[model samples]
Target: MGLLVKGKWYDKWDYNNDEGEFIREESQFRNWITKDGSAGPTGEAGFKAEPGRYHLYVSLACPWASRALIMRSLKGLEDMISISVVNTLMGENGWTFEEEEGVIQDPVIHADYLYQIYTHVEPEYSGRVTVPVLYDLKQNKIVNNESADIMRMLNSAFDEVGANDKDFLPENKMTEIDEINEKVYGTINNGVYKAGFATTQEVYEKEVTTLFDALDDIEERLEHSRYLVGDEITEADWRLFTTLIRFDSAYHGHFKCNIKRIVDYKNLWRYTRELYNEPGVKETVNFDHIKKHYYRSHKQINPNGIVPKGPELDFSLDK
Candidate 1:
């Protein structure tokens, strides 16, 4: 919840606006990597597909960063792209690779904090140091930090260099996927944060209501369809999976998004278990990191910083 100002670090959280609504900042880096060194849908070009040329910085606790990790596993890019995971606790320094369980330290720059990597890319970098950061080691710069863009890039950018040929963004279903992604991103994905971090009661009520409405709509949709888009799992499903997986565990009580838990909706609960049981998808999930980061990092919300140990969720597919 901290940001860098003119290359200096400040421990603060300014995500709320005058209306007390949580506003997520747009990622600063927007470059893309193409299979043939061509420019992607956005940003400049020349980032070609190559093995061992890109590194991913992520935190298992973060849903945004988890998108890239899940895509990496689904697209079979584990060998093509290296990854470094930060410690679950986001202390004053903000996302450190401090030696701890589940922390995978940065091997390229050996930086202490995540912001150091941003400043290393741009000496006077000024922005929120968020992950999943897609760094180009050959250029020694961040190719992208936006999770949505990074996930798309990982979906097919490295196919020439042994990435799986899975087409999460198939052309035939692009329109439907885009439509679904737009609604889900606003109401469900970001809506929970808006409700949880609201400074006023009015903002919280509005956001929380919108969140459940979206969930209800999705529950109805899944009643007949196996996945979000088509018969097989698509990018849309994975995008929503990150938020849904964290909803009952973190968002319900911690974020005050308690209109109803995902498990309460029979269809949604079954859908979540199906996705969680997907190949390599379960491996990307770490409930311990997810619970720790939300409870401990957001001191403004949980002043005591006492991590909860209950709420035993049944992600089991058996019933």
Candidate 2:
């Protein structure tokens, strides 16, 4: 992992001495593409919804990036907006375009590294170059890098252009969906990182316990409801589902979030399987890419970089 300091690349992991916590910095771009071509919370108005106007840069391994990819496929925006997959193993230069197995090369600019795209957008851009970047093909700039915002755009913005059938974030369920998203994002989604990257044992124990506590709560909540907010599959369910799908497979062992495997939680496990079986959802997941990225990339976590082959998950076979 690397970050840009005054537009210069520096290969270093995140650190926070004051709090003794692995604090994740918020994404810089937070724009949206509405139907009316209006400006979002940030950025300009030229990023209007148009066919072949946008291209998404993502990694199949990343849950955050996977969220956008899922939305794109479900919304039927595949033809409207193109995509590029970065190599899963984020190395000294962070996300790169080194073609290896399933890692898709940068087709838009043919850049050697993903950070090159950031520098292309803004020479002085200073932040972590994260995935799920919505690039404006017409303007040749990053529309938004925030996955949450990109999900919203993919959910609604391109209705007139195409994919007008599916509405992941229905208006009636907005409030409930938002509430679910908040809980999942904080506790379960980012909780794995909180537990894994904890500098102290005390911090790790606190986060791991909190992570499972939230999982238990969700497992209980999912007992009656088919989805997080209601019987209908909404944005909230998709958001939480991504993390749950990755829980036992990656987070449990690699991230040291080993309180209990997600498979042990009956409701969560079934719910995860249900989501994974959804139309176009399963295609977004690339387990080989996901597993290799985590095990090999984080040398500190897995010093030998020898990827594991067991645990025998059957997510690929139909539920």
Candidate 3:
């Protein structure tokens, strides 16, 4: 709900005055860890891919962090890289490591707040401390916090360290992957936030209608094909799947993006169940964390902080 100013934390949530929409901050660290120790976007060299050299800081409630978790689990990098989950409900500062179920307390530095970790790397760091932070153990700094870049890094960089062989972003399909990622991010991934945090009725209507319109397009696309990109499951599918899986549970009601639930969409519903059934993917999702965080954290949206109990999701049972 807040950000750091010159390494000082503040508690201010005034993005939306009339509407309760949400606006995401830009990620700070843009560096990458390539296979040949090459520099990416930003940062110095010598970030060679090695086993047990990196750790991921994430929050289960965050879709951006969830994307990295999916890639980490699918790539079989559990042993290579460690992870710490911050509490879902962002408090005065932002993501925290409060002792809770499925939440990993800060291990390396024993810090309570996530911004502390950011300041540890750069004392004067001025930005929002977001999740899916790829920390470099050797350098004692953050390698990358951008989820899209992290997804690509996890997909390819750690092969020498025995990470999973599955390539979510195959070279031949990079063009298509990029195309789908843009649409999904604009309409679905960030669309709900635009709706929930919209400052005006016109803005909310525009975003919500766009959100459902994008969903309808995806639903129709999935009706014929098994995945978004051809029959093979690509990075695009997994990235979109996390948002769809969370739509009915959180965005539909919490974000006021209730045009229609993914459950109401025939193709999207089945496709969501299918993705949830993926071996490592399902384990990363914690509905309790997701529900409690959104409902309790955003006091502006739900003043009572009371979470609903119905709309049970049986992703495990069957289609």
Candidate 4:
């Protein structure tokens, strides 16, 4: 709902352009964490993979942040890295660490809002204060704010430091995984937001149509295969799972993505259940936070801020 510019906070929500298309800002922090403390792909080196050296700040209400959370769970990095979660309702202040039912106070810097973390890292930091933020506790700087990079780091960077050896981006499936991830990231992962936040009817129609098309394609793919990449669960599955889990609860009604609920899709619904039933995954989901954040935060979309009480989502393992 807001952004930081030259270390200054603004209560602005002008993400749409002249055409009313929601243009998501690119993540600014691009540093990396490697096992040898060397550089991985982008940004600087020296962020060696170590135990209890980094901290993660995430919002359970956020899909991007949830991606990192799922990776952390799958890779078993809970003890190595500490974490703090923000409150569900993001208002004018935009993602504050306020006291609430699920709020986890920021122990590193004791900041009231997420923006303070940005200012603490770089006094003149100019960008959206986003999560999940990978903070280097030793250097007292933000390691990375980009979710995709954070997932990759969590997948393998801490493997030497007692992290699980399971490779989501296995060598044999790397190419297919990358290809599927690219498609899903643009159309399905971000497509719901593009549809939800679109200010014009024309833009909304275009985006919503593309989103369902991608979902339809995915449903067909899952009809014969157990997962997105088939047989095994990759990072692609986890990445898409965050959005799918939130679809019926938040996106379907709140975002006007009502053409077809995920429950209507036989294959997709089954696939979602499979992923949700995965070890250490269901606990990461917070439906209260998910519903409240979207329904209350976006006053422009949902002016009343009245959260709905019934979608009747009962995600459980089938006996």
Structural similarity to truth (TM-score) of each candidate: 0.98, 0.96, 0.96, 0.99
After superposition, candidate 4 runs with Cα above 4 Å error? none
Tens-place lDDT per residue, model 4, 46-109, is 8999999999999999999999999998899999988999999888888999899988999878
Sorted by TM-score, highest first, which candidate order results?
4, 1, 2, 3
- Backbone clashes in candidate 2 total 0
In model 2, the worst 10-residue window by lDDT is 13-22
CA RMSD of all predictions:
0.9, 1.4, 1.7, 0.9
Q: Model 4, residue 228: what's the lDDT?
A: 88
The candidate, 1 or 2, that scores higher on TM-score is: 1
In candidate 2, which residue pairs clash?
none
lDDT per residue, candidate 1, 110-223, as tens digits?
A: 999999999998988888999999999998989999999999988888887898799899999999999999999999999899899999999999999999899999999999
- Model 2 / residue 316 / CA error / Å: 6.9
Assess candidate 3 and give its lDDT.
0.87
Clashing pairs in 1: none
